[model samples]
Target chain A: MNQLNSTQLETLRNDLKARGLSLFVLKDELLDHICCLIELEMEKGISFDEGRQIVFKNFNSAEMLRNQKKTKWIYQSKKFKRKFKSVLSAAAVIMLMMVGGVEAQETPDGHPIYGDCELASGFGIRRDPIYKIKRMHSGIDFKAKAGTPVVATADGTVLEAVSNPDGYGNKIIISHSGEYKTLFGHLSGFNVKTGDKVRKGDIIGYVGSSGRSSAPHLHYEILQGDKKINPELFISK
Target chain B: MYSKELMKGTLKTIVLKLLKEHEKMYGYEITQKVKDLTQDKIQLTEGALYPTLHKLESLGYVYTEKKEYNGRTRKYYLLTESGQAEATEKINEFAEFVLTMKFIFNSKLAAE
Candidate 1:
C-alpha cells in the first residue's frame, strides 16, 4: 500500500477537524480505507492529485461527522432530564381510557388517513443540520417540496399549532383515537390550528425548511401515548 | 472485471470467513481484511460493506457491541453461534467449488 506523505496526512487531519471529528477519535482503519482507495486509483493510471479529488467527491465528510455526533448524543441523551412533563401527563390520561375497556372507534378501512408514504429519513441516529450533533432523529422525514400540501396522517383533533422554542420551527401535533398522536414539524405554514377536527389526508400545512432543518422536508412522527414508535411500521410505504 | 452477479454470490461467504477468524471487527476493518487476504484482487467499497453488515445483523448472523476506542465509540460486530456454524459451512462449500473448477480447467489445458 502506498503510504500518504506527511503533508497529505496533515491536510486530511485538517479537513476532518473542520468536519467536527477530533484527532483523538480518528480511527487508523478508516484512514487506511481512504489511503487504499487513493492507491488503487493511482494504479489505474489516475494521478495522485486526481485520486485525491475523487476521494473527496465520493466520500461524504459531513455525513461521517454527523454519525460521530449521533454516537455522542445517544449516550448523553439517556441522562438529560425531560423538559416537557405535560406531554407525558396527557399520555397517562389516554392510557387510562384504554384500560377502562373503552374501545376507540376505528375509522373506516381501519387505516390512518394517509395510505401511501415514503421515508424521507428514518427515526434514529442522524446528523442534525443545525446543531451539527449526532442526535436522535426522533421522527421520520417525508419528501415534500416547498409549498407542497402536508396532510394529516390520521383522524385527530389538532392539539397544538403554536410556534414555540422547541426548535420544531412551525409545528403541529394532533391527538388521535386510542391515545395515539402524530407530530408534524418544520412546516412552512399551518392551515389547521388548535382544536380543529381533521380527517386523514386533510391538508394541514405546507412543507418548508423551518426550524433545525438543512433542507425542505416534512418531519412526521407517531407516538403511542408518549413513546415514539417506528412510523414506517404503521404507515404504508 | 468479475461479473457483478458472481461477486454477489460469494460476498456473504467471504465476509463470514473473515469474521470467523477475528473476535470482532468494524466496517473499515472488514473491508481492509478482504483486500489484504485477497492480495488486492478484491476490494469492498463503503456502499457495499454497510448494507451487507446491516443485513447480516438484522438476519441474526451478527451482533454489535459499542466500545470506546481511540476516544471514539465504535460499533464492533461479532458472529453469533449460528453465524459461526454458517461460516464453516460456507468456507467448505467455497473450497470444494474452487477445487472442482481448478481440476476441470487444468484437464482442459492438458487436452489442448
Candidate 2:
C-alpha cells in the first residue's frame, strides 16, 4: 500500500475541515478511509490527483456531516448517562428513554415496505384530505393501491389489529422494544392478529381506504409512548 | 451489492464480530474485509461505517488506539471485554432473525 505524503495528508485534512467535519474522531477515521481508497487506486497506476478525485467522488459531504452529528449525539448521550447514573430515578429514566429514542432513529433501519410509493401527506398539521380543513396529521400517508402489502417497520408484538367502519378502518399497532410503537392504519385486511410477534418487514396488512380515508393509502405513525412522531423519520428513503 | 437498507441494521454486528475474530482493525480494513467476506455483495460506505464505529466506542463496546505507520497515523479499533459479550448476543440475535425470516417465507409459500 502506498503511503500518503505529509503534504497530501494535509490537503485531505483541510478538505475535510472545510466540509464541516469538526469532530476530531470522525475526521481522523474519514481521513484514513479516504487515504486507503486513494492508495489502492494509486496501486492501479492512477496518479495521485486522479486517485483523490475518484475516492472523493464516493463521498457526499452532507451525508458525512450527518454521520458526524449522529456520532456526537450518541457520545453526548453516553456522557449524560454516566453523569446521571448515580441519581437516576423513574422520571429521569423516562427522560433518558425519550432522548435515546429520538437519537436512535437517525436512520430509517426498518422501512415499512419496498418499492416506490409517493408520499400523499406528511406528518404535522395539514389540510385534511377528506374534511378539507387543517388538522393534525398524526402519521404519513403513502399513496398505494388497494391490497398493497404493508409491512411492519420493526420487530414487535401486535398490540391491536381491529376493523372499524369509521376511523382508521382496519388498523394494526405493533409495540416494539425501547418504548416505541408503530401503527399501520387504513389497511384492507390483516395478516397478523393482536399478540402475534412480527419481525421487521413482515406483512401486517394490505393497503385500503378504510374509515375516514379519501383514497387508498397507507397511513403510518411512529409513537413514543402516547406521543406520535413523524413517520418519515423511520421510513428509509 | 446488497441494498443499503438491508445492510444498515447489520453493520454494527458485522463490525463487532470482525473485531472479536481479528483483535484489531482500522476503518479501511474493515470495509475491505466485509467486501471480501461477502464476495463484494455487501459494500459498506464510510458514511455508514464510521458512525457505527463511533457508536460502539461511545457505548464502551470498543476502543481505539492510534499508531504511526509510514508518514501518517492510523487508528485501530478492538473490542472491549463487554464488546465480546455483545458480539455473542448480536450474532445469536441475527441467527434467530434469519430463522424467523425463513419461516415467514416458507409459510407464505405454503399459503400460496
Best model number under lDDT: 2
lDDT of each: 0.71, 0.85
Query: What is the Cα-based lDDT of residue A187 in candidate 2?
Result: 90
Top DockQ hit: 2
Instruction: Report RMSD for candidate 1.
Output: 24.2
Q: Model 2 misses residue A208 by how many Å?
A: 79
lDDT of 2 by residue, B1-112 (tens): 7777778889999998899999899999999999999998888888888889988998899999998765666899999999999999999999999999999999999999
CA shift at A227, candidate 2, in angstroms? Answer: 53
Clashing pairs in 2: none
Residues A1-237, model 1: lDDT tens digits: 455676766666565566566533233435545665677777888777789889879887665565455544533443342433456767888788766634473221222223243456788899876788899887788766777777877777999997754578889998887767888888888899999998877888888778877777788778887988777777652
Q: Each predicted complex: what DockQ?
A: 0.07, 0.42
With a 3 Å backbone cut-off (N, CA, C), the pairs that clash in candidate 1 are: A69-A134, A70-A134
Question: Model 1, B49: alpha-carbon shift in Å?
Answer: 1.5
Docking class of 1: incorrect
The TM-score of candidate 2's chain A against the true chain A comes to 0.54
Model 1 TM-score, 2 decimals: 0.36
Q: Which whole-number lDDT from 0 to 100 does residue B55 have in model 1?
A: 57
After superposition, the stretches of candidate 2 with alpha carbons farther than 4 Å from their true spots are A86-237
